[model samples]
Target chain A: MSSPERSSTPMALIVVAWALVVIPLLYGLVQTIRTASALFTG
Target chain B: MAVPGFLARDRIVAKPGFNRWLIPPAALAVHLCIGQVYATSVYKAALVADFESSLTAIGAIFSIAIVMLGLSAALFGTWVDRNGPRAAMFTSACFWSVGFLVGAAGIATNQLWLLYLGYGVLGGIGLGIGYISPVSTLIKWFPDRPGLATGMAIMGFGGGALIATPLSRQLMSLYDSSYDGTAATTPSGSAVALLFVTFGLVYLVFMMFGAAIVRVPAEGWKPDGFDPSTVKSKALVTTDSVSAANAIKTPQFWLLWIVLFCNVTAGIGILEQASPMVQDFFRDGDASLVTAAAAAGFVGLLSLFNMAGRFVWSSTSDVIGRKGIYMVYLGVGLLLYVALATVGSSAVWLFVLLAALIISFYGGGFATIPAYLRDLFGTYQVGAIHGRLLTAWSAAGVAGPLIVNGVLDTQGTPGELVAGDYRIALFIMVGLLAVGFVANLLVKPVASKWHEPKSQTSPTPERSAAR
Candidate 1:
């Protein structure tokens, strides 16, 4: 079940795919940290 | 014929140039949407008000969803392996979104059974299918780093609550002006109904995006500079593939099941009561030193640790090996429970730090199990095995809270409990972790008798590749 020769992928597409998921993830991380910080201050 | 042609296993095979990295994001899309299950607490109060129901009645919705998650995963696991990730993802999206829409109708009409059928049964099925969809694909793509690959995807499940909690709050606030995202206020049923519709639509887009972009690797593809033979050199790592049907017969699978059940059961002792537990620990005469807000913040902090551990500790398994990593999760976890029971209340920082580490280990156990299974059972039907294993989690979900809450109930009434009231429950968790540690120790490579025949197991050249 050997595959055919590998082909080159566009770097831009890789970056776009990653950013699509990462952006929402970062937003959530920031929100959680902001809420959790109250553990110390409150 | 039930599955569309486009969603077929063969149709979504990676082209020669397909970048393997694109797959993780696609996996994350579905995980993040279904992970909303954990964030159901955000709306628990509103549902109670809407139905004029007791807290237990409302809480049963979440319980039902979790129970169905286990059942559906076990029942459909082999079908998922046979059909492939795309079909599974699409099926999940349809079930999940329709569930929300049906739940919206339930809320709008004040019919509780519809909500139970929709979110609890249908949505739970989505959660089960979505949870395992990408696991085997990720393992195949990064056989050299299976832990890291699965970790990246599963981490989204933990992190999904981080997004959904705040997002749900904001959406509810938008839908109802009277609600301020606080305990003092509750959103109207109409607001919640609209919120479900919005969530249903949004999740449909994200999950469909995942199903559209996901691809299985080409047959026999390997990453540059990665030697498949080297993977077998690791302890308990198998080159041979086992069928999911055969996997359940092995003692190793049951051992890992116990390991996961104990780990999750112990973690939920803290998670199930995070808010009130912190307040009770620091109680001073009539009022606790910790405020309600701080207790909430502690829950948020635990969420961060749980999310971080899923990625960090699971990826570390790639270096340390899965068995070594689980020893740390189970062995050290037992001692941490002891410390938490004894001196955890002496200081707030001490309590937080101990619980955080335990929760991290808990998350690590969940994220690492797939890689562990891949090592022991091989990847022939790992997604199916993973689905089967998750029944342990469902069992733990019931047992963990029952043990904690039952102990607490016997100690004293809810609002009047103190640090002493919790010791018995915490100690019980310590005992559960001890059992898990021994289970982890007992796990070994599956016997050759359990392996699928080579002719039946081997991938054909035209078949899309799986690990």
Candidate 2:
């Protein structure tokens, strides 16, 4: 529900939650890319 | 009576300025953590050797957890809605983490039954509750874009595997000094036990987000600019609510069950066979067009698409409408299966492209259904309805593999099979998609007798604020 009040999410909490989701995905992506690159080089 | 301070039922009460956007991340926190269920195979062989038990026995542990997941959701769906997400999440976090702890002890002591009881039965109840705990709240919060909201969380379930697979390997290597990270070299028994304990503690801390931050909207709090009238214009979308008990009696409910069943079963026809299918398609006596390593890469590529499709297609459903999006999944799915059947294996790029798209639709099929349930059944007991419907996934889990494996076994062994050997299974998948299409077409709004009385449908200020 929309409220006239601005987002109450703490600036600190936002970083942590985003990190919770984004960091793992980024790591997985880098690992996958490395594996794919090796496959091509071989 | 709920325990003082422990009873989180009051968390559902929406305060005046509560932010709805925080809810998706909270839901993601739980789903991603519990989704480690898919990565259990990373430890399977090690457990088998350590306990000196069969692979079947170890695999049964996962089966117990999944079956319990469905049963717990069906039994507790209504209780969850009444008690609220915080309570359900709290209990789920307890069961899930305890299941891991018990499982860790089981592995340490080399007791198989303890492992099953801890991770299988108790942990499954955790999975079921955790899975559904966020659904009804997400729907209520994002009534205007239920598809997009639920999709973000459910997509976590799909992505959880991607994260878990690698993380499990890394954790195992970290714990086991002797570890060489390869499929053949397994993690140590002690290492797996430690892994379980670590997962238990990590998940307990993570799942608390939904339990703490989640709140229900106060009565009559619609998002700004959202017209309640627009929901009616979408086919089968309803403003009314249905009791979870009466919902099963309706044809629409069963039809949706069928839609989910057929879609999941058809999708698994590819997923279950992904590794072998690519290799088999290009086999030529001793020289295969696709290498075994290349085929593994293909599987990894499909996993990425599978996760993406859950977020992308389900979010798209918000714009095109729920029923219209399902039509895309089923109708286009049928055509894709046909292409894979008739002319698949013709080229490297062609086969990969079609297979990846098909898998995306597979993931899309799962992510979109919760929003569809919200559309047809109303948010009254959607979590429970969703809980009951997961029985379709469990059923398809068995049936899909049987059809594919059965058909393939008849053709030839895995490596020796050729493109022609799979045409039968591919055609079968096309037929399965067709059945899903018809089920989608048959869905309609629930009748009035089953609907929650009008007064109860809207959140009342007195009752919401009563706590």
Candidate 3:
């Protein structure tokens, strides 16, 4: 089977792609700060 | 006359669908996890407090891990290329997970050597393999967009600490009963062990996802609308593909190595002592405004800038070209270091901001160099060349911390709060960046002798027929 061809420059796709990347990163960041705080305090 | 068949087979290129994207993310997942090396200071502080160890003794663990990262990467890089990223990544996952588990056990038992062996030696192996695995594959997939693609994967590496630093701190807190600053009252050894095991399992799964999705494009294939000429015209020294093996022999490779070594060493000096440095700077005769929590937070903020630089500045390289990008990293980086040395105590915010920018450039340097190599050397063996160049990182890892801590120690005032103490170290970093700037300027195009012209040989009938 051939590779699926999506629009190369779709705004929606780019937005979704960025969202996927950003959300996990932000979540990770929150987790990091929370952990550091606990370590320092504990 | 003797062996046309042997020569033809050696010249044959592998078909596409070798799994490129899968490799970089796989590499990233492991690297991001191993990037915990940056956060080892937190553990060191805890160890120092709990075991009542000397700073030099505590530092030995981190030093061992870093030294091992360089040695193992150089040794395993060739293996990854020969065996493929799957085996290499899987091995990395195993060693890294075990290292954490071993470290957890060491903490429970209060056995410092085990922590050193586990995290330093075992985990260091994971770092070496994970780092080099996806580099060449990413370059292959985005031969036309090497900087951006390689940057995407490597940027994750810079960000890895951003995630690990805080997460580890949290995990330590969760497992411990008391929230005391003193390390002696922290959690049981078994609790730390459990956390390591959990982290390992999660990392293994994420890395496997990356490995499963990676595929190499067909040989000579370009993205449907991509133009090779556009890439060549935009880059500093354009060349057709050269395998990673041959790429190292060229002057461009050595110049790139010097650039990375300088950038990494400069950034690491600050990173190694980020928390203490912030505390010392803001400390006054009456009382210090910078709390331990704030210092850790500052480290996290630096991590944010470090991570951001990796993605943003390196991606910018795709547009402005790698050489132009390095000029920014080196030139702007030097200015920021100078500003920090001079204006650091007078205006605290400026020091923080400038320091963040310098750290970002440090992260950006690591993320961007892969693309720089892709620009000068073909993707054929970029991984190997990148692997070889990592010896510079190994060297800087030792040099950076030694310069920072050595200066701090020799001053003979561990508890004597002072801002001017770090001035000499900052100047040292400035000189290093200057050397890097000169090395970057000296980089010339790869000689034509190194290029592999297509006309020198014909394609195999079987491969051509398949296409």
**Alpha-carbon RMSD of each model:** 2.3, 3.3, 6.3
Q: For candidate 2, write residues B1-467 as lDDT tens digits.
A: 34345555554566665667777877888888788887787799999999999988998898889889888988777767767788888888999999999999999999999999999999999999999998888988998888898889888887777777778788989999787767768889999999999999988988876577667776677888899999878778888888677889999889989988998898889988887888788788867877766776777777778878999999999999888988989999899999998888898678888998998988998889889989887887788789898888888877898899999899987678999999999999899889989989988788988887777655332332221
1 versus 3: better TM-score goes to: 1
Once fitted onto the true fold, the runs of candidate 2 whose alpha carbons sit more than 4 angstroms away are A1-11, A33-42, B1-6, B458-467
Give the backbone clash total of model 2.
0
lDDT, candidate 3, B160-215, per-residue tens: 66666556556767776563434345544455566666676777676655544444
Top-lDDT structure, candidate number: 1
Using TM-score as the yardstick, the better of models 2 and 3 is 2
CA displacement after TM-score superposition, residue B142 of candidate 3 (Å)? 2.0
TM-score result, candidate 1: 0.97
- Per-chain TM-score of chain B, candidate 1? 0.98
Candidate 1 vs candidate 2: the lDDT winner is: 1
Ranking, lDDT, top scorer first: 1, 2, 3
Whole-model Cα lDDT of every candidate shown, in order: 0.90, 0.83, 0.71
